[model samples]
Target: MTIPKRMWWQNSSVYQIYPASFKDSNGDGVGDIPGIISELDYIQSIGVDVIWICPMYDSPQVDMGYDVRDYEDVYRPYGTVQDMEVLIEQTHARGMKIILDLVVNHTSDQHKWFLESRSSKNNPKRDWYIWRPARYVDGQRKPPNNWIGNFGGSCWEWDEHTQEYYLHLFCPEQPDLNWENSATRQAIYDSAMEFWLQRGVDGFRVDTVNMYSKGDMVDAPITDPKSEWQFAGFQYCNGPRMHEFLSEMNQVLQKYDAMTVGECPHTPDMAKVLKYVSRKEKQLNMVFQFDVVDIGQGPYKFQTTPFNWGLPQFKHAIETTQNLIRGNDGWTTVFLENHDQSRSVSRFTSDAPQHRVAGGKLLSLMMSALSGTMFIYQGQELGMVNFPMEWSMDEYKDVDSSNYYKMVADRSHNDPKEMHVAKTSLQHLARDHARVPMSWSDAPNAGFSAAKPWMRALDDAAICNAKQQQSDKSSVLSFWKRMLQLRKQYSDLFVFGEFDLLDKSNLEVFTFTKTWQNKKALVVLNFTAEEQKLVYPTEVRSQKSELLVSTLDTPASDKLAAYEGRIFMLES
Candidate 1:
């Protein structure tokens, strides 16, 4: 495999902004584009090269902007098209790029296209969406197949007007589009890409990209016949024409020198995934796989009875992804926290007050040193943790979490013990944990808004807010700034080096080496809250080594502090 010449995107770090929870400027309790503009300096201060704002398109926000109604316009609460134009201009002036979330797997039921498609079976736009007739079973009408949605309930929703059921892999309001139709695909390009690309935006974070090409309509396999969520993932994921669609999308990106990173869920085949991102294929710059995120998942991703923690298991998953694309032309997008996952500090490390900062630094360093682009979620630099378990169900606002809670309640009715466990699972793994308004200051609403916030900040925002961390030299935010500087200084070494996981038998510690040309860099990380000594290989001992960076202010010889990480540069 040959190393390709570095591009601007390859060398830059990404900061993901969940628009609604980032900052609110109108005192209307919702974040807007101007709110983001207010924080431009704060984002630039952290040294990130790109800002990926989540969908702010026109919609009812049934899925918090993922359900797009107008792909070419901004949501009213988030500002207008003029505001977005200024945002793009201001972002470029600051020497940083901005990308918008492209959620095209489905369209809101309110969309003009959907409205036309569902108007009548004989409508010219009838084939724009996946609509099927209901089947009769035992003298009762039922859905066409046993497919289930990601947000709960059957994937098929009956439309009284058309007398047919429409497929929705997510919320029923978000109907799946028929990518099999060439006209529909062209509309996606025209609205989602060409319009935004012409406005001077950077690229896109393709939502559910692999689901664009679904297979023949059929009843999916079932593991638990009684459960409401059927195993229909294969029916709409990584389908036969997935690569073809992505390759076509790449043509649009290449014309504008833009980049794209696709969200590829439930796709375990590395060879198949590589096909979508290989340089030769020209499909995408990289892909985000959930191997590491699925560490604690049960048979199904959202099942309550997930496996308990074992550091070695996590290490194996990360190393597997690293090795998969190390020497190949395929690239991986490395991240631990995002809009839909739990915070990394609480999920992957000991979140005790004493170790939180160290653990945050360790994880940031590990991801930064890997051979791919790094994505930093908003507030992650401040070492944010999950919301307090004390929050009740009413306090949570995510649609997916609410739907799952009702499903669990119906299945395990009147069983208080089972209900409690399921609630705890939601508390730890729900998408809303990362969706709370960012903690910008210690003031009310954590300074995210002057008015009441749509979602309350975590209880510990007083201590974890960015204002507090920015003032303290030893805070996680400060360490993140330093880490970004180091990455910029060693761009080629970190982005082009070959990775090798070392001491795999050592469960408590994670270690790896990145070698490029005649130089080698070793990264050491301790997963526990207890100090440990490094056991260097014989080759490392003989090299001329220089201390590069460490989580601790000062290290005791050969010893690592609780949850500490360190990097060493060796000259051969």
Candidate 2:
């Protein structure tokens, strides 16, 4: 449960930008690498330390860049390798780090490796992909197992040339790699990924890192006969060879002085997270924890509207995650929104649009002040809310939502639409909700581009534009700037500070204390629509804690207002 070394990354604040939606330079409707480069000044101004980019690799775009045809090459839509190099240089020049998304769990069926593997049974690269003979029982065509794809069908994709089933946890075009092959592992470590590290890229944000090493023992008995992907995820995810492979990767990273962060599913067990990010082995620097992001959802197909999620659960998950981190090993990557989620304002607050500002500010202060690295997705700084567009069925790109509509919505003879509704609600909870394009200007296309956007930006781009927020002192952007600067300025209070949760009586507000030496800081946040108060702790109320940062114009004790948050500090 101890972090042996005090590395710089242990306390850095990271900002994530989904490249395709960040900014489009060429006015080609889709965003390019140059678009991101253009926004460098804006990002640097916000006081973020690291910029994590989702996959920009060349792909068929079938699953919206998840299916990478080339692991190393930048897609022409994103720009050339030279463009990325320029972005990396700009980031370093501005004193920020660059993080690349590594999708090593699977390769696009179009990848040269998969092409060769699928070419013939006798091909030298035949063993690189998982291929097995189809199962036959009672003269029926079936997958080798009852495993299902996240997209709703079988995990097995048929290969016409080889007369075999190739495994894919996602789209059929994305075939899972067989990590048992040592040669394949070496190739992944050596290929397109090494290109950036040699050029001084800071680190990697490993995508679906656990999927690479699956349990090799085949025909395992099902644990839950109801859910397919869950069974497969349990079987293959966090498998036998994961630690060995991650340790080897860590060895390479150790030589370069870079970092690696695995995208582990949002779970509460520190022991599970410690397996990959702990110091004894140091396989990864941290993991993206998805504790608070699980709230909010809706029904799908016949019904597709979000429902109210109680706020207490969100506070509980956050406290639970913080306690786990405080009680265990390694650091945590904390975030409220990202490329894959619906906007935070829409998720956390009630239906009142007016409360968005107070809500955003409250969320920012509470999350950033917590110990460990903080991740602020783009537009989060500007308080971007969810896209209010009435999305037609044709405009949707999310795989999970689309599949549920088709399977449980239409052909499946499932009883009622309860399961489909539940599936839709969960998809809404997934991070994809917030992945829409950033709104940089209120100009045509909201300054993201001069052309149409690939995905719609949030509905209120007029008010949420960076150009607008940058000028207003009371804007969400300003609040974020203040929060970020405070953290950087008061490292002792934020970076290495120990967290102690306040009494649980205030469910409408969350409070905590951070003490080091004689200095103390009390953090309080109001989560409900009504005003809330925190009775200061007996030990420090009179001596140490003082008002440090507050989202309220006046303390709730002074006036009754909804969505106010406060952070108080004690004199040394």
Best by lDDT: 1
Predicted structure 2: lDDT: 0.75
How far is each candidate from the true structure, as Cα RMSD in Å? 1.5, 3.1
Q: Indicate the worst ten consecutive residues by lDDT in candidate 2.
A: 296-305
- The residue-level lDDT of candidate 2 at 417 comes to 63
Candidate 2, superposed: residue stretches over 4 Å from native: 1-4, 217-230, 266-268, 296-309, 327-329, 411-432, 537-544, 556-560
Question: Model 1, range 462-563, lDDT digits (tens) per residue?
Answer: 888999888899999999999899988887677667788878778789888888887789988888888898767665767777889988898877888888
State each model's CA lDDT, in order.
0.87, 0.75
lDDT of 2 by residue, 159-229 (tens): 87889999998899899888899999888888746777887788888988777776763554565465553
Clashes of each: 0, 11
